[model samples]
Target: MQRKNSILRSSKRGGFAMIMAIILIVVLTTIMALTLSLTSQTTKQTSDLYLREQAVLLAKSAAELALLKVSGWNRATSGCLTSVNAVYPSTTNKIFDINVTMKYIGLGCGGSADYIPAIVTPESNGTVLMDVTVTSDPGVSTEPIRYFRRTLQKL
Candidate 1:
Protein backbone atom coordinates (compact mmCIF):
# COMPACT_ATOMS: atom_id res chain seq x y z
CA MET A 1 0.00 0.00 0.00
CA GLN A 2 2.86 2.38 0.80
CA ARG A 3 4.54 1.76 -2.56
CA LYS A 4 1.23 2.31 -4.43
CA ASN A 5 0.67 5.63 -2.68
CA SER A 6 4.19 6.85 -3.56
CA ILE A 7 3.65 6.01 -7.28
CA LEU A 8 0.36 7.89 -7.37
CA ARG A 9 1.95 11.00 -5.84
CA SER A 10 4.77 10.87 -8.41
CA SER A 11 2.26 10.66 -11.30
CA LYS A 12 0.35 13.69 -9.99
CA ARG A 13 3.57 15.72 -9.74
CA GLY A 14 4.44 14.85 -13.39
CA GLY A 15 1.03 16.00 -14.61
CA PHE A 16 1.38 19.32 -12.75
CA ALA A 17 4.79 19.92 -14.39
CA MET A 18 3.27 19.37 -17.86
CA ILE A 19 0.55 21.94 -17.14
CA MET A 20 3.14 24.48 -15.98
CA ALA A 21 5.17 23.97 -19.16
CA ILE A 22 2.09 24.61 -21.35
CA ILE A 23 1.34 27.83 -19.50
CA LEU A 24 4.93 29.00 -19.89
CA ILE A 25 4.84 28.33 -23.67
CA VAL A 26 1.64 30.32 -24.05
CA VAL A 27 3.07 33.32 -22.21
CA LEU A 28 6.25 33.32 -24.30
CA THR A 29 4.29 33.11 -27.55
CA THR A 30 2.13 36.10 -26.57
CA ILE A 31 5.21 38.22 -25.75
CA MET A 32 6.86 37.33 -29.05
CA ALA A 33 3.79 38.26 -31.06
CA LEU A 34 3.47 41.61 -29.33
CA THR A 35 7.13 42.43 -29.96
CA LEU A 36 6.78 41.68 -33.67
CA SER A 37 3.68 43.85 -33.97
CA LEU A 38 5.32 46.81 -32.24
CA THR A 39 8.38 46.57 -34.47
CA SER A 40 6.26 46.59 -37.63
CA GLN A 41 4.32 49.67 -36.54
CA THR A 42 7.48 51.57 -35.65
CA THR A 43 9.01 50.81 -39.06
CA LYS A 44 5.96 52.08 -40.91
CA GLN A 45 5.84 55.31 -38.93
CA THR A 46 9.52 56.01 -39.53
CA SER A 47 9.13 55.48 -43.26
CA ASP A 48 6.19 57.87 -43.41
CA LEU A 49 8.07 60.59 -41.57
CA TYR A 50 11.07 60.26 -43.85
CA LEU A 51 8.93 60.49 -46.95
CA ARG A 52 7.17 63.61 -45.67
CA GLU A 53 10.44 65.38 -44.96
CA GLN A 54 11.75 64.54 -48.40
CA ALA A 55 8.68 65.99 -50.03
CA VAL A 56 9.00 69.23 -48.08
CA LEU A 57 12.61 69.66 -49.10
CA LEU A 58 11.77 68.99 -52.72
CA ALA A 59 9.03 71.59 -52.64
CA LYS A 60 11.34 74.23 -51.22
CA SER A 61 13.96 73.62 -53.89
CA ALA A 62 11.36 73.75 -56.61
CA ALA A 63 10.08 77.06 -55.33
CA GLU A 64 13.57 78.52 -55.44
CA LEU A 65 13.97 77.30 -58.99
CA ALA A 66 10.73 79.00 -59.95
CA LEU A 67 11.89 82.24 -58.44
CA LEU A 68 15.08 82.12 -60.53
CA LYS A 69 13.08 81.48 -63.65
CA VAL A 70 10.79 84.43 -62.99
CA SER A 71 13.68 86.78 -62.24
CA GLY A 72 15.37 85.89 -65.52
CA TRP A 73 12.25 86.58 -67.56
CA ASN A 74 11.90 89.88 -69.45
CA ARG A 75 8.86 91.47 -67.72
CA ALA A 76 8.10 93.64 -70.73
CA THR A 77 7.90 90.71 -73.17
CA SER A 78 6.47 87.86 -71.02
CA GLY A 79 3.13 87.63 -69.32
CA CYS A 80 2.88 88.70 -65.70
CA LEU A 81 1.77 85.27 -64.52
CA THR A 82 3.19 81.94 -65.60
CA SER A 83 2.56 78.32 -64.72
CA VAL A 84 5.30 75.70 -64.92
CA ASN A 85 4.76 71.99 -64.26
CA ALA A 86 7.66 69.55 -64.20
CA VAL A 87 8.41 65.98 -63.19
CA TYR A 88 11.67 65.03 -61.55
CA PRO A 89 14.08 62.46 -63.05
CA SER A 90 12.11 62.79 -66.30
CA THR A 91 11.98 58.99 -66.40
CA THR A 92 9.25 56.42 -66.59
CA ASN A 93 9.30 55.89 -62.83
CA LYS A 94 8.11 59.45 -62.08
CA ILE A 95 8.80 58.94 -58.38
CA PHE A 96 8.55 62.68 -57.73
CA ASP A 97 6.95 65.63 -59.49
CA ILE A 98 6.53 69.36 -58.89
CA ASN A 99 4.07 71.99 -60.11
CA VAL A 100 4.95 75.65 -59.78
CA THR A 101 2.45 78.41 -60.45
CA MET A 102 3.56 82.02 -60.35
CA LYS A 103 0.96 84.76 -60.28
CA TYR A 104 1.57 88.47 -60.49
CA ILE A 105 0.21 90.22 -57.42
CA GLY A 106 1.73 93.66 -57.90
CA LEU A 107 1.16 96.56 -60.26
CA GLY A 108 4.47 98.08 -61.35
CA CYS A 109 5.95 99.45 -64.59
CA GLY A 110 5.73 96.10 -66.32
CA GLY A 111 2.67 94.71 -64.56
CA SER A 112 -0.46 94.67 -66.68
CA ALA A 113 -4.03 93.37 -66.49
CA ASP A 114 -3.27 90.71 -69.08
CA TYR A 115 -1.81 88.43 -66.38
CA ILE A 116 -4.40 88.41 -63.55
CA PRO A 117 -7.03 91.06 -63.98
CA ALA A 118 -9.60 89.76 -61.54
CA ILE A 119 -7.22 89.45 -58.59
CA VAL A 120 -6.29 92.32 -56.31
CA THR A 121 -2.94 93.85 -57.27
CA PRO A 122 -0.49 95.36 -54.85
CA GLU A 123 0.40 99.06 -55.32
CA SER A 124 4.13 98.57 -54.79
CA ASN A 125 6.92 96.94 -56.81
CA GLY A 126 6.34 93.87 -58.95
CA THR A 127 5.59 90.86 -56.73
CA VAL A 128 5.06 87.29 -57.83
CA LEU A 129 3.33 84.67 -55.73
CA MET A 130 4.77 81.23 -56.37
CA ASP A 131 2.98 78.08 -55.34
CA VAL A 132 5.04 74.94 -55.47
CA THR A 133 3.69 71.46 -54.90
CA VAL A 134 5.86 68.39 -54.53
CA THR A 135 4.51 64.88 -54.80
CA SER A 136 6.28 61.64 -53.97
CA ASP A 137 5.21 58.08 -54.49
CA PRO A 138 5.57 55.78 -51.54
CA GLY A 139 5.31 52.29 -52.94
CA VAL A 140 4.06 50.67 -49.77
CA SER A 141 1.33 53.21 -49.03
CA THR A 142 -1.80 53.77 -51.10
CA GLU A 143 -1.63 57.56 -50.72
CA PRO A 144 1.28 59.53 -52.12
CA ILE A 145 3.27 62.03 -50.08
CA ARG A 146 2.64 65.68 -50.99
CA TYR A 147 4.10 69.01 -49.82
CA PHE A 148 3.12 72.53 -50.78
CA ARG A 149 5.13 75.73 -50.41
CA ARG A 150 4.14 79.29 -51.26
CA THR A 151 6.62 82.11 -51.65
CA LEU A 152 6.18 85.79 -52.55
CA GLN A 153 9.14 87.15 -54.46
CA LYS A 154 9.78 90.65 -55.73
CA LEU A 155 11.22 90.98 -59.19
Candidate 2:
Protein backbone atom coordinates (compact mmCIF):
# COMPACT_ATOMS: atom_id res chain seq x y z
CA MET A 1 0.00 0.00 0.00
CA GLN A 2 2.74 2.47 0.82
CA ARG A 3 4.45 1.81 -2.47
CA LYS A 4 1.16 2.46 -4.29
CA ASN A 5 0.61 5.71 -2.39
CA SER A 6 4.17 6.83 -3.27
CA ILE A 7 3.46 6.15 -6.92
CA LEU A 8 0.29 8.28 -6.83
CA ARG A 9 2.08 11.16 -5.11
CA SER A 10 4.87 11.10 -7.68
CA SER A 11 2.37 11.29 -10.50
CA LYS A 12 0.63 14.28 -8.89
CA ARG A 13 3.98 16.03 -8.44
CA GLY A 14 4.90 15.42 -12.05
CA GLY A 15 1.61 16.90 -13.24
CA PHE A 16 2.10 19.95 -11.03
CA ALA A 17 5.61 20.48 -12.37
CA MET A 18 4.33 20.39 -15.91
CA ILE A 19 1.69 22.97 -15.17
CA MET A 20 4.25 25.24 -13.50
CA ALA A 21 6.60 24.92 -16.43
CA ILE A 22 3.84 25.97 -18.85
CA ILE A 23 2.92 28.95 -16.68
CA LEU A 24 6.54 30.05 -16.49
CA ILE A 25 6.90 29.82 -20.26
CA VAL A 26 3.75 31.90 -20.80
CA VAL A 27 4.93 34.59 -18.38
CA LEU A 28 8.35 34.78 -19.97
CA THR A 29 6.87 35.02 -23.41
CA THR A 30 4.60 37.88 -22.38
CA ILE A 31 7.51 39.76 -20.85
CA MET A 32 9.67 39.29 -23.91
CA ALA A 33 6.90 40.50 -26.25
CA LEU A 34 6.36 43.61 -24.16
CA THR A 35 10.08 44.34 -24.12
CA LEU A 36 10.31 44.06 -27.88
CA SER A 37 7.36 46.39 -28.39
CA LEU A 38 8.85 49.02 -26.09
CA THR A 39 12.21 48.82 -27.80
CA SER A 40 10.64 49.28 -31.22
CA GLN A 41 8.67 52.31 -30.07
CA THR A 42 11.76 53.88 -28.55
CA THR A 43 13.77 53.37 -31.70
CA LYS A 44 11.06 54.96 -33.86
CA GLN A 45 10.79 57.97 -31.61
CA THR A 46 14.54 58.48 -31.64
CA SER A 47 14.64 58.27 -35.41
CA ASP A 48 11.82 60.80 -35.79
CA LEU A 49 13.52 63.25 -33.43
CA TYR A 50 16.78 62.96 -35.28
CA LEU A 51 15.08 63.59 -38.60
CA ARG A 52 13.29 66.62 -37.22
CA GLU A 53 16.53 68.14 -36.00
CA GLN A 54 18.16 67.60 -39.33
CA ALA A 55 15.25 69.32 -41.08
CA VAL A 56 15.51 72.33 -38.76
CA LEU A 57 19.22 72.65 -39.43
CA LEU A 58 18.71 72.38 -43.14
CA ALA A 59 16.02 75.05 -43.00
CA LYS A 60 18.35 77.47 -41.22
CA SER A 61 21.05 76.87 -43.79
CA ALA A 62 18.60 77.43 -46.63
CA ALA A 63 17.40 80.67 -45.05
CA GLU A 64 20.96 81.93 -44.82
CA LEU A 65 21.54 81.11 -48.46
CA ALA A 66 18.40 83.01 -49.42
CA LEU A 67 19.61 86.03 -47.50
CA LEU A 68 22.93 85.91 -49.34
CA LYS A 69 21.21 85.68 -52.68
CA VAL A 70 19.02 88.66 -51.91
CA SER A 71 21.99 90.71 -50.70
CA GLY A 72 23.78 90.08 -53.99
CA TRP A 73 20.82 91.35 -56.06
CA ASN A 74 21.58 94.37 -58.27
CA ARG A 75 19.16 97.17 -57.33
CA ALA A 76 20.01 98.99 -60.52
CA THR A 77 18.20 96.32 -62.53
CA SER A 78 14.73 97.37 -63.75
CA GLY A 79 12.83 94.15 -63.13
CA CYS A 80 11.87 92.70 -59.77
CA LEU A 81 14.61 90.83 -57.90
CA THR A 82 14.81 87.15 -58.73
CA SER A 83 13.79 84.93 -55.83
CA VAL A 84 15.68 81.82 -54.82
CA ASN A 85 13.70 78.62 -55.20
CA ALA A 86 15.61 75.44 -55.57
CA VAL A 87 16.41 72.08 -54.03
CA TYR A 88 19.63 71.36 -52.21
CA PRO A 89 22.39 69.00 -53.43
CA SER A 90 20.62 68.66 -56.85
CA THR A 91 20.97 64.91 -56.43
CA THR A 92 18.19 63.09 -54.62
CA ASN A 93 18.71 61.30 -51.33
CA LYS A 94 16.72 58.24 -50.42
CA ILE A 95 16.29 59.45 -46.88
CA PHE A 96 15.59 63.18 -47.01
CA ASP A 97 15.14 66.14 -49.37
CA ILE A 98 15.36 69.87 -48.69
CA ASN A 99 13.50 72.55 -50.66
CA VAL A 100 14.00 76.29 -50.29
CA THR A 101 11.71 79.06 -51.61
CA MET A 102 12.39 82.74 -51.21
CA LYS A 103 10.01 85.64 -52.01
CA TYR A 104 10.88 89.30 -52.08
CA ILE A 105 8.62 91.79 -50.29
CA GLY A 106 8.40 95.60 -49.91
CA LEU A 107 9.50 98.49 -52.16
CA GLY A 108 10.39 97.14 -55.61
CA CYS A 109 8.95 93.75 -54.76
CA GLY A 110 5.19 93.09 -54.76
CA GLY A 111 3.07 90.59 -52.80
CA SER A 112 4.40 91.86 -49.51
CA ALA A 113 0.95 91.73 -47.92
CA ASP A 114 0.63 88.04 -48.64
CA TYR A 115 3.77 87.08 -46.73
CA ILE A 116 4.06 89.83 -44.15
CA PRO A 117 1.50 89.97 -41.36
CA ALA A 118 -1.08 92.75 -41.47
CA ILE A 119 0.20 94.02 -38.10
CA VAL A 120 3.69 94.47 -39.51
CA THR A 121 4.73 96.29 -42.67
CA PRO A 122 7.73 95.48 -44.81
CA GLU A 123 10.90 97.45 -44.02
CA SER A 124 11.75 100.48 -46.20
CA ASN A 125 14.83 98.74 -47.60
CA GLY A 126 13.04 95.44 -48.45
CA THR A 127 12.06 92.08 -46.95
CA VAL A 128 12.68 88.55 -48.02
CA LEU A 129 10.58 85.65 -46.84
CA MET A 130 12.20 82.27 -46.98
CA ASP A 131 10.33 79.00 -46.62
CA VAL A 132 12.25 75.80 -46.24
CA THR A 133 10.60 72.43 -46.39
CA VAL A 134 12.32 69.23 -45.40
CA THR A 135 10.86 65.85 -46.16
CA SER A 136 12.16 62.54 -44.83
CA ASP A 137 11.20 59.02 -45.66
CA PRO A 138 11.90 56.28 -43.18
CA GLY A 139 11.95 53.18 -45.33
CA VAL A 140 10.19 51.03 -42.76
CA SER A 141 7.42 53.54 -42.09
CA THR A 142 4.35 54.08 -44.23
CA GLU A 143 4.17 57.79 -43.42
CA PRO A 144 6.79 60.32 -44.43
CA ILE A 145 8.03 63.07 -42.11
CA ARG A 146 7.82 66.71 -43.25
CA TYR A 147 9.21 69.80 -41.55
CA PHE A 148 8.69 73.42 -42.57
CA ARG A 149 10.58 76.51 -41.49
CA ARG A 150 9.76 80.09 -42.46
CA THR A 151 12.09 83.03 -41.92
CA LEU A 152 11.58 86.74 -42.61
CA GLN A 153 14.63 88.89 -43.20
CA LYS A 154 15.06 92.60 -43.97
CA LEU A 155 17.36 93.25 -46.86
Candidate 3:
Protein backbone atom coordinates (compact mmCIF):
# COMPACT_ATOMS: atom_id res chain seq x y z
CA MET A 1 0.00 0.00 0.00
CA GLN A 2 2.77 2.45 0.87
CA ARG A 3 4.53 1.91 -2.51
CA LYS A 4 1.27 2.36 -4.42
CA ASN A 5 0.57 5.67 -2.68
CA SER A 6 4.07 7.03 -3.46
CA ILE A 7 3.68 6.21 -7.17
CA LEU A 8 0.34 8.00 -7.33
CA ARG A 9 1.76 11.12 -5.71
CA SER A 10 4.69 11.13 -8.17
CA SER A 11 2.31 10.90 -11.14
CA LYS A 12 0.32 13.87 -9.88
CA ARG A 13 3.46 16.02 -9.49
CA GLY A 14 4.59 15.16 -13.02
CA GLY A 15 1.21 16.12 -14.47
CA PHE A 16 1.32 19.49 -12.71
CA ALA A 17 4.79 20.21 -14.04
CA MET A 18 3.70 19.43 -17.63
CA ILE A 19 0.75 21.86 -17.35
CA MET A 20 3.04 24.64 -16.05
CA ALA A 21 5.51 24.10 -18.88
CA ILE A 22 2.76 24.38 -21.48
CA ILE A 23 1.49 27.63 -19.95
CA LEU A 24 4.99 29.09 -19.92
CA ILE A 25 5.47 28.23 -23.56
CA VAL A 26 2.21 30.01 -24.48
CA VAL A 27 3.17 33.13 -22.53
CA LEU A 28 6.61 33.32 -24.15
CA THR A 29 5.08 32.93 -27.60
CA THR A 30 2.68 35.84 -26.93
CA ILE A 31 5.54 38.09 -25.87
CA MET A 32 7.55 37.23 -28.97
CA ALA A 33 4.59 37.98 -31.27
CA LEU A 34 4.04 41.37 -29.65
CA THR A 35 7.72 42.28 -30.00
CA LEU A 36 7.72 41.37 -33.68
CA SER A 37 4.60 43.50 -34.31
CA LEU A 38 6.06 46.56 -32.62
CA THR A 39 9.32 46.15 -34.52
CA SER A 40 7.51 46.07 -37.85
CA GLN A 41 5.66 49.31 -37.06
CA THR A 42 8.87 51.05 -36.07
CA THR A 43 10.60 49.97 -39.27
CA LYS A 44 7.81 51.31 -41.45
CA GLN A 45 7.82 54.67 -39.68
CA THR A 46 11.57 55.00 -40.14
CA SER A 47 11.34 54.25 -43.85
CA ASP A 48 8.63 56.87 -44.36
CA LEU A 49 10.69 59.47 -42.55
CA TYR A 50 13.70 58.78 -44.77
CA LEU A 51 11.66 59.17 -47.94
CA ARG A 52 10.13 62.44 -46.77
CA GLU A 53 13.55 63.85 -45.92
CA GLN A 54 14.83 63.09 -49.41
CA ALA A 55 11.83 64.76 -51.02
CA VAL A 56 12.25 67.89 -48.95
CA LEU A 57 15.91 68.16 -49.85
CA LEU A 58 15.13 67.81 -53.53
CA ALA A 59 12.49 70.54 -53.32
CA LYS A 60 14.85 72.90 -51.53
CA SER A 61 17.58 72.36 -54.11
CA ALA A 62 15.18 73.04 -56.95
CA ALA A 63 13.99 76.23 -55.27
CA GLU A 64 17.56 77.44 -54.89
CA LEU A 65 18.30 76.75 -58.54
CA ALA A 66 15.21 78.69 -59.60
CA LEU A 67 16.27 81.63 -57.46
CA LEU A 68 19.71 81.62 -59.05
CA LYS A 69 18.21 81.71 -62.54
CA VAL A 70 15.89 84.58 -61.64
CA SER A 71 18.69 86.60 -60.12
CA GLY A 72 20.75 86.24 -63.29
CA TRP A 73 17.88 87.36 -65.54
CA ASN A 74 18.63 90.47 -67.64
CA ARG A 75 16.79 92.00 -70.58
CA ALA A 76 20.00 91.93 -72.63
CA THR A 77 20.65 88.24 -71.96
CA SER A 78 17.17 86.67 -71.91
CA GLY A 79 15.55 89.10 -74.41
CA CYS A 80 12.08 88.84 -72.74
CA LEU A 81 10.43 87.75 -69.53
CA THR A 82 8.05 85.38 -71.28
CA SER A 83 10.90 82.97 -71.92
CA VAL A 84 11.43 80.09 -69.42
CA ASN A 85 13.57 77.00 -69.00
CA ALA A 86 13.57 73.59 -67.37
CA VAL A 87 16.73 72.04 -65.88
CA TYR A 88 17.37 68.49 -64.73
CA PRO A 89 20.15 67.19 -62.57
CA SER A 90 22.88 65.19 -64.31
CA THR A 91 23.39 62.48 -61.75
CA THR A 92 22.75 58.77 -61.79
CA ASN A 93 19.19 57.85 -60.80
CA LYS A 94 18.50 61.48 -59.84
CA ILE A 95 14.75 61.95 -59.94
CA PHE A 96 13.82 65.65 -59.76
CA ASP A 97 12.23 68.23 -62.09
CA ILE A 98 12.70 72.01 -62.13
CA ASN A 99 10.65 74.63 -64.03
CA VAL A 100 11.20 78.41 -64.08
CA THR A 101 9.41 81.55 -65.37
CA MET A 102 10.33 85.20 -65.47
CA LYS A 103 8.72 88.68 -65.22
CA TYR A 104 9.94 92.26 -65.83
CA ILE A 105 8.82 95.88 -65.30
CA GLY A 106 8.54 98.42 -68.13
CA LEU A 107 8.25 102.20 -67.81
CA GLY A 108 5.30 103.99 -69.50
CA CYS A 109 4.02 107.65 -69.54
CA GLY A 110 0.26 107.18 -70.29
CA GLY A 111 -1.51 107.94 -67.04
CA SER A 112 -4.33 110.24 -65.82
CA ALA A 113 -1.78 112.37 -63.91
CA ASP A 114 -0.92 115.73 -65.45
CA TYR A 115 2.52 114.39 -66.40
CA ILE A 116 3.49 110.87 -65.27
CA PRO A 117 7.24 110.64 -65.18
CA ALA A 118 7.06 106.92 -65.90
CA ILE A 119 4.67 103.95 -65.83
CA VAL A 120 5.57 100.65 -64.34
CA THR A 121 4.68 97.66 -66.47
CA PRO A 122 5.05 94.19 -65.02
CA GLU A 123 7.14 91.94 -67.21
CA SER A 124 7.15 88.22 -66.60
CA ASN A 125 10.31 87.59 -64.58
CA GLY A 126 11.75 84.11 -64.79
CA THR A 127 10.79 82.47 -61.52
CA VAL A 128 9.98 78.83 -61.10
CA LEU A 129 8.13 76.55 -58.69
CA MET A 130 9.52 73.07 -58.21
CA ASP A 131 7.82 69.84 -57.30
CA VAL A 132 9.80 66.94 -55.83
CA THR A 133 8.68 63.39 -55.39
CA VAL A 134 10.46 60.34 -53.93
CA THR A 135 9.53 56.71 -54.03
CA SER A 136 10.79 53.57 -52.25
CA ASP A 137 9.87 50.04 -53.22
CA PRO A 138 9.66 47.56 -50.40
CA GLY A 139 9.14 44.05 -51.68
CA VAL A 140 7.26 42.92 -48.61
CA SER A 141 4.13 44.96 -49.33
CA THR A 142 2.16 45.63 -52.50
CA GLU A 143 2.33 49.42 -52.08
CA PRO A 144 5.51 51.40 -52.68
CA ILE A 145 6.75 54.28 -50.55
CA ARG A 146 6.07 57.73 -51.94
CA TYR A 147 6.79 61.34 -50.94
CA PHE A 148 5.90 64.69 -52.56
CA ARG A 149 6.96 68.30 -52.04
CA ARG A 150 6.30 71.71 -53.61
CA THR A 151 8.62 74.71 -53.35
CA LEU A 152 8.79 78.12 -54.99
CA GLN A 153 11.75 80.33 -55.78
CA LYS A 154 12.70 83.16 -53.39
CA LEU A 155 12.17 86.67 -54.71
Best by TM-score: 1
Q: Model 2, stretches more than 4 Å misplaced?
A: 1-8, 75-94, 110-123, 137-142
Model 1 over residues 1-155: C-alpha lDDT tens digits?
45465766676898899999999999999999999999989888888888788778878888878878777777676655476777766757776778998766554424333234333544534677788888875663556788888887766
Runs of candidate 3 with Cα error greater than 4 angstroms are 1-8, 73-155
- Poorest lDDT segment (10 consecutive residues) of candidate 1: 109-118
C-alpha-based local distance difference test score of model 2? 0.68
Q: Which stretches of candidate 1 lie over 4 Å from their true place?
A: 1-9, 107-123, 138-142
Local distance difference test, per candidate? Answer: 0.73, 0.68, 0.50
Q: Which 10 residues in a row give candidate 2 its minimum summed lDDT?
A: 110-119
Which residue pairs overlap in candidate 2's backbone?
none
Candidate with best lDDT: 1
lDDT string for model 2 (21-131, tens) is 999999999999999999999988987787777777777886788678668766567444445555434546456666666665554444432343232443434776777
**Residue 15: error of model 1 in Å?**
2.0
- Greater TM-score among 2 and 3 belongs to 2
